[model samples]
Every structure is written in C-alpha cells, then in structure tokens.
Target: MQFIDLKAQYERIESEVRARIEAVLQHGQFIMGPEVGELEERLADFVGVRHCVGMSSGTDALLAAMMALEIGRGDEVITTPFTFIATGEMIALLGARPVFVDIDPVTYNMDPAKLEDAITGRARAIMPVSLYGQCADMDAINAVAERHHLPVIEDAAQSFGASYKGRRSCGLSKIGCTSFFPAKPLGAYGDAGACFTDDDALAKALREIRNHGQDRRYHHPRIGLNARLDTMQAAVLLAKLDIFGDEVDARSRLGRRYTELLTARGAGSTELGGDAVLTPFVHPDNVSVFAQYTLQVPDRDSVAEKLSASGVPSAVHYPVPLNDQPVFHVGLPGEETPVGARVAQRVISLPMHPYLTEETQLKVVDAVAAATGLAGS
Candidate 1:
C-alpha cells in the first residue's frame, strides 16, 4: 500500500482541482494571483487567525517567521531534537543557535518541563514542532515562553488540521507555520506554506518578508527572500481546502481504528514494556490529524525489513535526533537528549491517509504483528 495515498485524494477532488487550476491559468497571474489572496483568507478563517501569509515552503515559512521576529546571529531558538532537520536548519541558516530540548517519552513532542531549562539569556524564541500531526503541549509551552518574554513559533508542518483545546494548530502561537509539500496532511500540488498570526504588525511584516521585503511595488524596506507561494499551488490548496474537514475527520477515525486494532491483537500499548509496539499517544485535549500513525518497536530495523518483505510499506519519521546530526552536533557525548535519542532509534511509521481501506489496514497490522513476533499475541 502507498505510504500516503495522494492519488486517491486527487481523484476525489479532481473536478474542483482542475477547475481551480484552469481559472489560475486563464488569469495568468502566476506569482501573486487572486487565488493566492483567496486561499489566505480561507486559511486565516479556518485557523481563527487574522492573517495567513502564504509562503514558498514550510522551511521558508519558519525562516520568515524568525526573520519577522528579528532572530539572527547570537540569538537562540529552543526546540526539540526529535524532528525534521528543517527546524534546526532554519535557525542555523539565520546564524542563530538552535538549543536542543528533550521530548516527552509518550508524545514524542517537546517536553514543556524541559522548556525553562533550555532557555538562556540569549534565547530569542521557542520553536516547537507538532510532530506526527498532533500539537505539542502549546498551553504549557506558551506559559513557559510568556515567563521568558519570548515569542513562540509552532512548526506545525505536519499538523495543519489538528486542534488543541478548541484552537487550531496554526492559530495556537504568536507565529505558526505549516507546510504543503504534497506529503503533509493538508498538502498542495507543489511547495507551499503559510504563517499564521493575530498580531497586525507581525502579519504585515510576514507578508512583506515573503515578497522580497517590499512594502509596496519597488519599495524595498528590509532584507528578505522570495518566499511567496505560487498562484497555482494556492489554487490547488483552495480546492483541497473544500474537503479538508472531511479528510481530517477520516484521518482521526483511522488513527483510532489503528490503535484499537493494534491493541486487540495484543501488539500495542502505551509504553514499550514488552515485545508489543508502543502506539502513539495523543493528549486528552488535542485532536490529532494523524499525519503518520507512528509506533515504537524493538529491533525497529528488523521489523521494517520484515514488513517490506511482506509487501507492506513503512517509514521512519526520523531516525536521528537533530543533536546527533553532523551539521548540528555540538553537544558533548554524554549530554545527549535521553528520551529523543532513544525514541529516534525505535520509532517507525506505518502507511496512513484518509483513503486507507480497512482491508489494507488489516494487512499492514498483521504484517507488523508478525514482524514484531507478536502475531496472535
């Protein structure tokens, strides 16, 4: 089965998608087209935010957010090490230091308890990633940031449709960024992203930053990058947006089903206590979109190989913690993030998408059970 069934999703929205694209083509305003503005309005409303500045990519969105916050050389951004390289890469790109923090053992997200310890005199911002489509503990993270008087940027690339305490993922922080890299929960046809905010000045700054820092035509005011989202991509997103709510619901249902089935076969639990896989744990207050239904298993490589041999595809959201990456590795050997390092070694993601069929899901689960030597419990 496909790891993410994008083709099936395309088929479902084929007509509307084509119509939107056709309209963009007819208008021929490829750069900052009308559809782009329409999408921004739609997205901002969906997230309950006042502004949504469309961007070139999720990485660019993060970079722009930091830029808007004036984070640069000598500044530090605190974030978890158990996520994609883009999080730390953006910090380093701006000549800022990326301070690593450990993740919660259960949620695999930045642990709020570890937040204050990571902050320092140079700490300029807290960038917490919402891993696997579930939001990080934003209320706790925000509280810590408030004490430090620092801004919070939610790297919500995988959690665009998720909710935390009745608030959407991209609307939960001072600056929230999400990706549309064709693989995310709410993906577009090509590279795209957005930054959400309620601050009027920050919103204006973000819009300018995405367009070469031009407040108006040929009026350059600040240093910036060409990070505007393309009109075609915006059109594609607008079409997908129409059905995104249903897709999010389906994904949530599938996630719950995965948990129930894995548990029923006696191969799933909350922790890695035995041979069974340790399933993902969503906080009681959050509604996860389940971008990936990840689990922790012993002998992860062996299990992956077995699953592949059985014609079941699987993937690792991330295998190496950012602190261990050659480019970002600066910590002493003994100072590794205990939980993030350990989880990175064992975490694996199974195929997940809204269109996943129960028959195929059962096959995947059985393959996983056999791989972990827990078949039939």
Candidate 2:
C-alpha cells in the first residue's frame, strides 16, 4: 500500500547496497570520491552518452547545464509550462526568461508545432521535459532547434531509463539532465542528479561548473556553485544500477496491466465521458518508465477523497500549470496555455513501483472504479 515501496527495492538490493556503501566508508574519500567517477561512467555508458557529470541535485544539474551554455540575463529559454517548477525555476534563477509553451493534450509534453511560434530574437535554448517518464518528441523538437540554431535541453528527471526510438532519454538532446530524487525511476538514497552530453567542451565545462568552476585544485576559471554529488549517493545509485534494467521491464509490464484492467472496467479512454478514466497514451516510438502511472479523472478532488476513504492512496503530479502559479503567472486567467491548464486540473497518480503486486494493483483499480461510478458497469 506504500506509494513507491522503496523499502521493497531496498530489501532486494540490501546486500549489494551495504557492500558499496561500506567500501566508500572504508575509503573515506567522501568528496570527489572514486565511487562518484565509477557511477558517472556506468551511467554515461547506460545512456549511450560520452560524458555524465554527477551533480548535487537535479535543480543544480539544470543550473550547471544552463551555465555551461552561457544562458543568462536577457536570454529567453523556450519551455513547456506543464512540468515541475524546477524546469522554469532554473532558467529564472540565472536571470533568463522562461517562455511558456503549451503541451500536447495526449502526451502532456511540449507540442513541437508550437515551437516555431514561441521562438524570438532572444531565444537561446529550447528545454523540453519528458513528463511522466515518457520522452518528448525529441526528433521533431530537435528539428526545430536545428533550424533556429538553438540548443535543446532535455529535462529527463522522470525518464532516466526510458527509451525513445532506440535511443536513451539522457542521450537524446544537446544536453540532458536527470534527477535521482528518492521517488524517481532510478532513484538514489538522497538527492542527486547528472548531466549528459557528447560535446567535449560542454562536458568539461559542466564538470567544472559543478565544483566551483575548478578545473584543477584551487584554480577557478569561472563563477560556479558547489554542486557535486555525494559519494554515498553515488554508491547507492551504483548498486541500484545493477538491477535497474530488470526494474524497467517490470514497470512497463505493470503500467500496461493497469491500463488493461481499467479499460476492462468501462473506465478507459474509449469510454471517455461521465466517470470514465483517461489513461496515459504512450507513443509507439517511445517506451515509458511509468514513473507515476497517472490518469485523468473528472471531479478529481472528489475521486481522490473517495480513494482515500477506501484506503487507497492517490496523488497529483501537478495541480497547476506553471504559467498559473503565482510566481510565474502571466497573461489573463483565461489566456493561460489552454491544453496544459485544462489537463493539470484532472491528472492524478496511483501508487506505482516495480514491486507492486497484481493483487494490490487490482484493489487500487477497484477503488478507482468505485470512485468514478463504474464499479458495476
């Protein structure tokens, strides 16, 4: 009944996790430890990238990537407004403007068709989030970026293990960043993140930016932040990486099962009206990690309340579009990006993890059926 069942994952990898951490502890090189480099190499290889720069957190990873790109005041970064605030926050923190673009209703990702219209003279980059563990349409987005001569940054925080058209998430764009927040698909014990790229200069710059701009000991060349990932977290991630491929398969199977079960109960997209539930639509070219297994439900507040009353836990990935948030709000109330604003109000997530049992999953679906007035239909 736990939302993520991290305890179960820990139990499965306890011995390896302990061994890795013990090795780090014995070495006592907490900062810039050997484990960090090992994890980075493994991750880079897994993602099919040339370099992986470990960072303190996903936010810092995004920050460092932007800094490496030289994004700053008066620069405008085009990005979707449907994602986590961190996507926009990083740009704002660097004194850059985050120009909001609406998302596609089906995928809930930035619509590539909208990209051209949003580009302006100051547009410096295009950042697309792989929301809910499925990558955005990278090819189309990259096509647009290429024409505009802009770099594309993939915010792959929820999609670390996902694949798009035979390519991995973090290797799909000019710069890709992912988080190891405890709940993410490939999570660590604590906050951690990494940036991936094939550009040698950008790779070197990212490494330096994460460590006070120091290319070598006490030699600072540019302004930067202390954003290095801790050795302990690197150890945990290394242990998890050993079993991550299997976990990814499990997550995909469970996600499909959830959709099938809901569809059978007359609560699926085919029955999208009244109390029917609208499940996630995965593109044929993409493999999702199902980080949240989210769905769109009408009367979301009441449905959530009923699920809670039935002892079934549910959560919302996001309740408001970024453009509607107080800190980022712009345009009139009705002028907000239409699709994202509407979708945000209806999205809700169920308890999802690789270890989730079918028995437990069935109960969750039954609870949803009851809450949506499709229990016997």
lDDT of 2 by residue, 309-351 (tens): 9888899988988888889999875275888887888999999
For model 1, how does the per-residue alpha-carbon lDDT over 1-377 read when each residue is reduced to its tens digit? 79999999999999999999999889899999999999999999999999999999999999999999999999999998999999999999999999999998888899999889888999999999999999999999999999989999999999999999999999999999999999999998889999999999999999899999999999989988999999999999999999999999999999999998888877555674445578889889999999999999999999999999999999998998899898988666316697887788889999999999999999988898889866482
Considering summed lDDT, which 10 consecutive residues are worst modelled in model 2? 267-276
**lDDT, candidate 2, residue 186?**
97
Off by over 4 Å in 1: 272-274, 332-334, 375-377
TM-score of 1: 0.98
For candidate 2, give the lDDT of residue 158. Answer: 97
Q: lDDT of each model, Cα atoms only?
A: 0.93, 0.93
